[model samples]
Target: MPGERKAETMEEVDLLVCGAGAGGMTAALVAALEGLNVVLAEKTAQVGGTTSTSGGTTWVPGTHLSEQAGVPDKVEDARAFLESVVANRGGARLREAFLASGRAAIEELDRKTDVKFVAAAAHPDYLDGPGAAYGGRALGPVMFDGKLLGREDFDRVRPPRREFMGLGGMMVGRNELGALLSPFASLANLRSTLGIVGGYVLDRVSYKRGTRLLMGNALVARLLYSLRKAKVPVLFESGVRELMIEDGRVVGAVLEGPTGTRRIRARKGVVLATGGICWNRKIRERLFPAGTRDYALGPQTNTGDGADVAMAVGARFDDGGDSPALWMPCSSYTRPDGSLAVWPHIILDRAKPGLFAVDAKGKRFVNEANSYHDFAMGQIATGAIPAHLVCDAAFMRRYGMGMILPGAGNLAAMLKAGYVIEAKTLAELAGRLGCDAKVLAETVEAYNRSASTGVDEAFGRGSSVVNRFNGDAEAGGSNPCLGPVGAGPYYAMAVRPADLASSAGLAGDEFGRVLNEEGEPIAGLYACGNDLASIFRGTYPGPGTTIGPAMVFGWRVAKHAAGKLTDQPETVSGVMTDERTKNATL
Candidate 1:
């Protein structure tokens, strides 16, 4: 074959990316700070995929961190709060390219690198609808010192989430879960729970894991230490088994990993950023919502492998939204080593002040401080699909259920491992959830007459601002989310709905490229976190609504793959071995 040279099984690069979360490491750290020639791959073996078990927040509205916290925001009031809660599902030019690249990709990744962030000046927006704000567009990540990712690259950063970590391996954050869950409330929450259990007993005698990296595992260990100080390689377990189309464009990717099958290429594109399609069960039974069930504990290597390798190369599938996933409500059990956990009710005991969720005729349904993506669609529009939540035993000995901890764990081995259930009455917790004990004591005497008049009047649980940002601001004159499941030995748990994020993806354009079904643009394809689509289609806006359009369309797919290079290098210098990137020295 004439001196057999077709670029020897190819492994080049001008940008390749594909799922290393936080929008594939902020589109391979802004296409390797413009110098390009990036790589990134990652299908697990750790590179912080589900954005390292989240809460790293990113929302981003009008910025300058809300004009230095006096709260600013306006891109026409974030386009009138995404046209009053994203009804157009990712259009209007991808929601005005996520309001002009969400504060210019967090002020150019904080002027280029240790990837800092701050703006949660009271995090709100999860819906006050039209131009909502309360807290200038979320923002979070300021705590990454995993010894600056060295100690063998900080043990490959991906901590936080052995069921949201704590004591048995540390890493707590969110203001140290309020002084380690209200340590006897004061004395400054007992010296912040003895300085967070003496810094996890001195971070377990010099680390093996907790080197103190906060949420979304300190934004994926500060974007994997800014892609290893802008050297940018990332590989991990690899993946993307297809997408090399030639004359049609997308020039590279056939990965697989551990050295089997290679073919990388990528002259100036290929971004994708998987982390979506919520554990795809044939795209969650063809776009969720009908007894939905991809069982979402997030990151089971988000099958939908970059939307089935970009819709098997002819991309297309935005399957619209409004709930193609992104709800919560999880609960599973098993842990005394047999592993199984799950948990995820998100927001500490559903905005405190006791709790509720019922049904099976025992009544009560949602608004237990809403937003767990609308309380799992208000338990499937109040049929309360497999519900229960309840709670008591003095709010389970000061907040803790679902992963059952407080007094630091074990409520009689989580009620003999049934995951939770205690009941000293409510007619023995409605005779152990078979419901009817006079309709669970008339739904706990009409929810203790709407918690002694803090007035839920059926479903108002601490009326909004994200339920006073997850309630209990010193629960004083009651309704800090209406507490009053008063002291019974009660408990409960047993719930359903899951999928933390998927909301139908693929379909792109205002620069992150990808798009088909005749709408055009697939050339050298691209996509950003959760592989595009969701421009609020499934609407869960704020508190980092899906990492602020996955860091603003992964910095608009690295400035549209650096403007399809006509011989780039007029200055993309973050130094990926300069010399004007002589074909990235392949």
Candidate 2:
């Protein structure tokens, strides 16, 4: 393939990054800062991919932010948490690299760029089982102004509409909501809310446009602004159709853009951060046979394009069984196009109290208030009839139900529509859902007894603030954790295990290099975010677990590609052409 005629194509860059999501953005920013000419391409018209739709929390323990917040986190504690959950799962080298590089990445972002970080005060780790801190381990992005980007016509990426509880009837974070509820805390929350409302109203009146509030959206805005400042050429609405390979190495890519087909070469590397296959129906049917109808909560553009392209180029993948990206239980509403806008928080408030999610034989399988990952895994492990959330009259009257507008009539309508079921008693409720009546009754009785004692002896239901947050506040007893509902009019609704996104893809080493079929690292190829198999394997250690690793790995990959490692060889030589060849040494 030597001296092959150069094909007519667009200009090349030092690095060509696909997918402008969190990982891709991080990689692009890092690479560009290292003096590499970078071009970041996104399939969507806008940048900030799924990160725009997330909570913007990154779980990194032993960081300076945590220390500044007065929550001391030790490396030993973090190691303990990892050992308790994800150690020895897979790719140990990668896990070590992640842990070692996470803090440095955060520091680099804070010092070199405007990516400010603040600890999510008091956010509990997912397990909280043992050696877990009650908050201060996770960091969230502070608010940034979108107007600074100077792209007034562009659709700025923001957090999911649900995560924004600000002015204009917006949503607030759980911690903020709790502060709003407490009398003393309410005063602070009130002041914050008023400030937000006042700023929004003034901006709207003066500018003749609604003011955009930042929470999670601030993370994306900051990244986008940084990318802009760095002058990284972002090709929007452009997707990689295939890896253009020659002489047994990747040279460029065939991109299907809005205008026409185009090929772009990469001088240094191609980073795959196109996200995972969460929305593809065919893949969903293959992976989740039972819950095929559940719409993914992530971006619709995530269709495993990167995985497919890598496979086409002779890359093997890990069998990420039972590990599809999952979201919380949601209710769907039909859109004008006759499709569905699936909401993610349907089961949180309504199903937390009297409702006990049971398997086929009517047995409680998991703590109701565990993280969504645990809850979804429980659904998968049950493998019986579809999970059911069992509830009572008190739960119905106080919490309302589902995604429908909160009202008694809506609840009745849902019941009539078969989305929810109701009966005069627990046995009757089980009978309606075709579950064993006696078993359900016993489960409810046991739960009620635990509620009376104020401690969930069975599953430690009230052990964490997350658990109590969703629990029935009015349930009285020595244990505010549980309350018995002996009253009539019980209910049950079928719940399907859902995912926020899938976490499996191309396998990478400690430096995020894509491995070939023979388990050898492919030079100049890197991956991060959900596009790479999770370093934790199947276990989630805490909140922001996914994003934290993504950012860390992204930085690692960028550094490695930029030849920052002193111990590593200065140069890795391989043929760079547009033709097929035998395996050659690097």
> Which lDDT tens digits does candidate 1 get at residues 434-540?
88899777777787788788888777788777886787868674677777777678888877788776767888876778887787888888888777777777778
- For model 2, residues 145-219, the per-residue Cα lDDT tens digits are 555765452255633544234344343554444443332555687786666556666655544323353545667
The 10 consecutive residues of candidate 1 with the worst lDDT sum are 571-580
What are the TM-scores, per candidate, against the unseen true structure?
0.35, 0.84
Candidate lDDT (C-alpha), each: 0.76, 0.68
Candidate 2 worst ten-residue window by lDDT: 577-586
User: Could you tell me the lDDT of residue 45 within candidate 2?
Assistant: 81
Q: What are the runs in model 2 whose C-alpha is more than 4 Å off?
A: 1-6, 128-131, 150-154, 158-171, 176-215, 280-289, 292-294, 321-327, 335-337, 345-353, 396-428, 455-458, 463-480, 486-493, 566-586
RMSD of each: 21.2, 6.5
